[model samples]
Target: MTETELLLSLIDDKLRKCEDGYMLTHTHFLSLGERSSAMAHLKNRYPNHVFWGGYPDAERSVLFLLPEYMEKDDFSLEDEDDPLCLVRVRASSAKLTHRDYLGALLGLGLERSVIGDILVGEHGAEIIVMKSISDYLIANFEKAGSASLKITVDSIKNLEPPKIKTEFIRESVASLRLDNMLSAVFGVSRSDAVEAISRGMVFLNDTEATKPDARIAEGDKLVLRGRGKAYFREQSGTTRKGRLSVLFEKYI
Candidate 1:
């Protein structure tokens, strides 16, 4: 079966489990694209559902299917009953990258679906993962790349994600079109931006953006797959050449 078909089947099974067994059910961590697809497919069919990944602004999230008596707000990421756990891995002084931590986790034979975000810091990383494997990780997860890791399982509340670093960019665009804004913020050619959008490599506010000419507004979040993420902070003013002066907070 196709990936989408398989995902839909899994969602159906989770829904069935929640409806028939009358309990909370959740899926493995899903990427941004997967979450968007799942939501588009399910829509208003399920009201007692939520997409969460231990935090509010998590790029990867799990879909929780709740019973009839429960509401989405009834679940808490910090609750002991939650299916997610925070694993803090500290190293002596070796700086580890996200890829290093991910490589080590996959090297340990863990599936990517079981892992959520890997927040890398100067000393180590904080990982959000399924609670089922928390103990195993604490016991077995040892090294990331060349850095020896000190692992500890903590409450989800203790997960301190690395502070985001952003670069403020001021540019002028002839229009607020998605492609135009992407070109200005990312320093890519207009044609390249359009091509990226056409190839489904661009996302606007967590949804896949297919139209190059789609109007972009202030406060919209844009993600260029291979590039990076940028937040349209404001339209400062109009340039002398009739272009719009835009400010973007580009995640560095």
Candidate 2:
């Protein structure tokens, strides 16, 4: 047998030994581009697995489970670790056209930008959804197999409304800045926020704030037409440049 087949078989064997009360339920996933046909394939093979779905924040590209996977009391973006098996399957890219293959793998609906990675463990399997797939899975594997397990997939809820902020920083405070005022306000990547600023997508109090490092005062109202809006508020504290820390709030 091929190495991957041997590994999957070994994992299946181990998973069959779960404690007397739970059933083994595997979570499988695929990118948006390959969802449709993939779901059809899975329906024929496993016919019993249920699925849940969700979208990640726009600026951050990926999809995760609804309600998320609880790992040690915290929700995780990736599935639990697996130790028994490993295999590499081809998947479409985030930018590719949406297709059926992805739905088949994840057993759920997904956005066009989602990516998938599959990892098999000693007693279970994990399907990861993210921009980049994990290269190693040796350290994160958890227990496998649930005997007589009852499964439930939940729904995803929108947590925060999306918004963007634009503002000007004083010269001194600008020196310590790793990013522009707009990004700080919106909590987005500096590069992305800057692009928006350059495109005249941002405004400071009704005026376009194109420069990533425009200097300004405490009460200025910044507006990013496409990204939402904010206002700056300077607080008490000096940085190495003898500049007080600048704070801003998106109008929400």
Candidate 3:
């Protein structure tokens, strides 16, 4: 088998529950093709259990759901116990990105024509299940490796939202000097921003403004094509002649 097929074989075997009447779920950050192949395996192996998948296009990751092992006393599920979990992962990529769990839920809400209560841990996204999804999480959580299982079944109870503070606010501008503005606002070296400015990455009001010392004023939109977008405001104060205090909102 190919490397991808081999990986799926391992995951399929590892995801099955030992007990009958148990459900299985799988979540991972595999590429699009890999996720499809895994789904196919689930279709063939376990047709009865609920199986779902999500591809966070912006974040470029996948999360799978298996809902067969939950402890539900009745059809009424508003009071289900411990339904969500968070697992911290050391992905192969060095850069870390966030997936907005609530954002995903909003989409599901639109699709189902119903709003559902989803409890997500502070660290990761939430998954909903009835009888089998819970079991799948447990089985996959173990097979996901100790390092991958950053969270456990118990942690999902009464989870709270994680807080993140805004570091900078973005604004629109007409034009700006490369070295003076970007260095102060973005906290980068003057030389580096200047270098990027010279390379024609910086723009003045949507047009590529190449001059590092370009005279920017209020109402001018400065867009750094690769980096982000910004707008310049009138000088509120001045630290130096070349360097003046200006208000700008930066795109994240």
Q: Rate the local accuracy (lDDT) of all candidates.
A: 0.87, 0.40, 0.44
The sequence of per-residue lDDT tens digits that candidate 1 reaches over residues 109-201 is 999999999887777878999999998898889887777889899888877655778999999999999999999999899999989988878
Taking the tens digit of each residue's C-alpha lDDT, what string does model 2 give over 122-235?
Answer: 332234343122332222221122122111121123222223343543322443232356666666777887787776566554444557777656777666655665677765
Better of 1 and 3 by TM-score: 1
Candidate 1 residue pairs in clash (backbone atoms < 3 Å)? none
Best by lDDT: 1
For model 3, what is the alpha-carbon lDDT of residue 189? 70
Candidate 1 shows a clash count of 0
Candidate 3, run of 10 with poorest lDDT: 51-60
lDDT of 1 at 22: 95
Per-candidate clashes come to 0, 31, 25
Clashes of 3: 25
TM-score of each: 0.91, 0.29, 0.31
**Model 1, residue 158: displacement in angstroms?**
1.4
Candidate closest to the true structure, highest TM-score: 1
